[model samples]
Target: MGKWNAKGLELAQKLEGVTDEKAIKKLATETMQEIIDACPGEGSIKRPRAALRKAIESVYPSLNAEDNYPQGYYRTSEGKGKGERYEHLALWYLTTNIDRWSVEGDEGRQQYWGNLPTLEKTEPKPQQTKQQKPKQKETVMSQLNLDLDTETQQALDFALKQSGLEEKEFISRAIAYYAKSIANRHEVDFATIPTEKLLNDSSLAKLPGRAEELTRRAVRAISIYNDDIAPENSERWAITQSAIARLTGGRAKSIQKALEDYQGMIADHHAKYELNNYSNRKSGGRTIEDTINIAEL
Candidate 1:
């Protein structure tokens, strides 16, 4: 059996007679929290959750299918508030399977439960030879030559003077900010439209006339931007502005206006559809639902 399966069996034996659902959930939550606290890094909870779930599944095979479990047994919602109900179910199964797990051997039990073995206990490093020379220290910093345009050079000089920071420090901060901005750029290539379409469409330069079309494109970009980008990053708004500018061939001011319009439109759309069931009723001889499909957007 796999490590988690064996661990699950062992856990089952230990949790024998613990039939209370609340008790089982508390034990599982505490176990996971302990693992997360011990590791103290990214994926600490995620890795242990996955392992524990696998172990639980080994004991209760019915959990693998939605039909075998109650409604909302896996997730509680469709959006950000969705809860992991399966984790609790998995823990309950482990407690109930004590008889089945008791048959497994005690081998490998020390590796997972109780105190995790230290690195030194698991594997020892090789000793250095007497004749071997110690390695030389490596350089930690790298030097780069930059060819800045007149405008950029002046900006950098002004920033350095205003901030009272060293030239290297100012440049380093600028580079870091620029790198993060570039990273926040739209993950999807202009909402899956070909680059050539936006770049080659010279007619997009004519603004105000094609403002509606521009707003539609901005809506799509905003939808994708919100889904992919984190709200905490201030650069996210700038990145979305840049995307709209590229898509519509418009200036910063024009793109900003388009974004404002897109936001208002989205709010109006949601209010109409949700409050009035506007999609089901007719308006101006046609159903508003037929006219506007937010899902398509």
Candidate 2:
């Protein structure tokens, strides 16, 4: 591929779109689904790994691609021949290099810059003239350090009390949402999506009772997300309700958020999981029902 020009950065920024703070926050969410949709499957013409390699090469064509995967690449064949060798290599490469973006600081959450490991800094040169002042040493700090002034803290506390959402709740949910947004952007496996079932159904439902329940719920949730049925409609609602219950272990507040997030994902994935139902026609899409029996589970 040719060099990744300003055009690529421009396209990525365009993909981000123009917006104010609130609008940007919402767009931050939609970007996650876009990343997920780009996930590779049986006939991946452009695997995420390959696409990333191309992007990196475009920027630094002289860089050795093999050096990027020193452990050698995995074959995409099935059974004993298939493994996660290359996938893991690609993950480490990206984690150590690209795949970074910044988020704007919110009320309780702050964003940080990410990059590959850096070499030690060299000492500053001595001033040539005595009149020149010595360079001040820099102090690095973690973002978690509280930067709020007393008045700002007081106002925030009062607002939380008035809103009936304790500071803990606000902070916890904000962190969860922000973290999920990042995961979505990076196309990291949503621990929420079950992959074990897709590989092998076997007697997954016959494991030890507790294990069986966990496996069953995961299989069902994966089914719902990958299915072609209308995920936002009534039929899918049952699955969403069950998924929330499973994820939150029956906590009311947890259930509320889980349900909201699950529905949000369904809406975000509408193009894949069509919302329309046509009983007479057979669909190439997977059925959300067969994968998950929420009421029975």
Candidate 3:
């Protein structure tokens, strides 16, 4: 009962109402075979076997009593000698140990058998020194106040109710996600753009707004998709098609189609750009400029 591993617990369960010695021995044999099969390696076999042996010896102490035969006599003998006799002894040990543990008082049981035969060998956890202890993370707290229009407030409420998130959590997450997306987008843009044009590009000013719009569209698409397939619950998007249409200014089907089209475009673009040294030019193909120069020549 005290954190017995699967095999040990199983043997114990099978032993219940099994008063016959033959049945117990058979169960012991089967359990030993299973343990051996589970752990075949020499290094891995010792602890489980020892635990099982201890269990059996505890229940039937007579088995552990000194044999009249000489120590090396059984090893040299052919049939049903020491190795064969104790081949399945581990299981009997486990069964007997389980029985003994069951009868003991609570304190005695805890003291003796509480941590026995988890089946896997467990090493003692090393004590953590003052220097080894993990340093606590310092959190900087900030406050924000937002004034919303009635329509915006209603939309925020609807989103919060549908998403099953607290207003503070949702707002914090939204801000964090938006900030991360903007930062990533800016980094990509900086890397890709020519240095001279980078400062002069008027379109750079609109990147944040474009990113926000794309982010909103993505979030809306995900929300619609979740609602369409999700199980019926308070958390599920339970809004009617007409309500969805009104909110999104398009039918659910149209929104889904648009999302699919957008995803396909993204996939196509990635596939197109992912290849190394990709170009429209064929091997040994002449450029239009080269043909024009030849004609001039």
Candidate 4:
């Protein structure tokens, strides 16, 4: 399309910024008529100069330019070869204000190339590219030293192997499991109720594992308290106590009450486990669980 001569260059210059296909076609038709008029003889079929043809081709990328697509002759072949023949003039038609055009045959074809020339401005738009942050490298791998007793160490190892995970991953998962089970997220007290209540309640019955879920949450809270409230644990600091009191609406007695409630839950579980069993099959021990006084225990 770049073989433009002096005349073609002049035509291109005349059609500059004229992106509308209709406008370009009108200009092209006017140019062709002028060329025909300039020919020495009236009936002479003059081949257009390379410059003129290049100018048109540059403007229109399609096979034939004029009116719209399929405006020129259709070359119908009987058998082999390159399929069809075109006897009409083919030229480029600009569809966008940008460097884009459609090939047209005459004023007859309806199909277009690239984007259809709209009345609205069709300039290619710039995009907003996001800037990404560079990732930071890990500096230190913080470690925890658990001085586990023989039984606990054995259990940890057994659990690590059983869960098919690395020691650190196993510990992390274990902590997450217990931590996530807490009822402290909402005010619902799972520790105070039995599974039967949730199971029997018509409203809760349809909720699968509602009782177990609540029970797990309650158990998690107890476990957290048992582990963290010890003097050695980081959570047992004076600041933590003050924070807890402040979180409980600055009620001085609330923390005490909560502690007593949590203690009661642990005692209840221990008492139940010790006394309520039908039998300890491994130990060959029998239980008179009903007769055991919880207060005495």
Top candidate, metric TM-score: 1
Best by the lDDT measure: 1
lDDT score of residue 192 within candidate 4: 56
| Candidate 2 lowest-lDDT run of ten | 133-142
lDDT of 2 by residue, 158-233 (tens): 5544544333454566568577556545532323435444224433322223233443454355455445544544
Q: Which parts of model 2 have CA positions greater than 4 angstroms off?
A: 1-17, 40-104, 111-297
Model 2, residue 64: C-alpha shift (Å)? 32
lDDT for each residue of candidate 4 in 1-297, tens digit (9 for 90 to 100): 332255666776766666555566655544543443344322331344444766655654333223243432333222365344332232432111111122344333434332343222233323321111111101111245566689987776555445544344556667775665453243454445554453245444323344334333334433444344434332221112122222222222333334443556555644543421122111222111222211122
> What are the TM-scores, per candidate, against the unseen true structure?
0.23, 0.22, 0.20, 0.21
Q: Taking the tens digit of each residue's C-alpha lDDT, what string does model 1 give over 47-117?
A: 55567666665654333334444421232222285433332243432321122121222232222233332
The clash count of every prediction, one per candidate, is 0, 1, 3, 16
Which segments of candidate 4 are over 4 A away from where they belong? 1-4, 42-45, 49-51, 58-107, 110-297
Question: Where's the lowest-lDDT run of ten residues in candidate 4?
Answer: 129-138
State which candidate, 2 or 3, has the greater TM-score: 2
Least accurate 10 contiguous residues by lDDT in model 1: 133-142
Which ranges of candidate 1 are over 4 A from the true structure? 1-6, 15-18, 63-88, 91-297
Give lDDT: candidate 1, residue 161.
Answer: 48
Pairs of residues at least 3 apart in sequence or in different chains that clash in candidate 2:
230-275
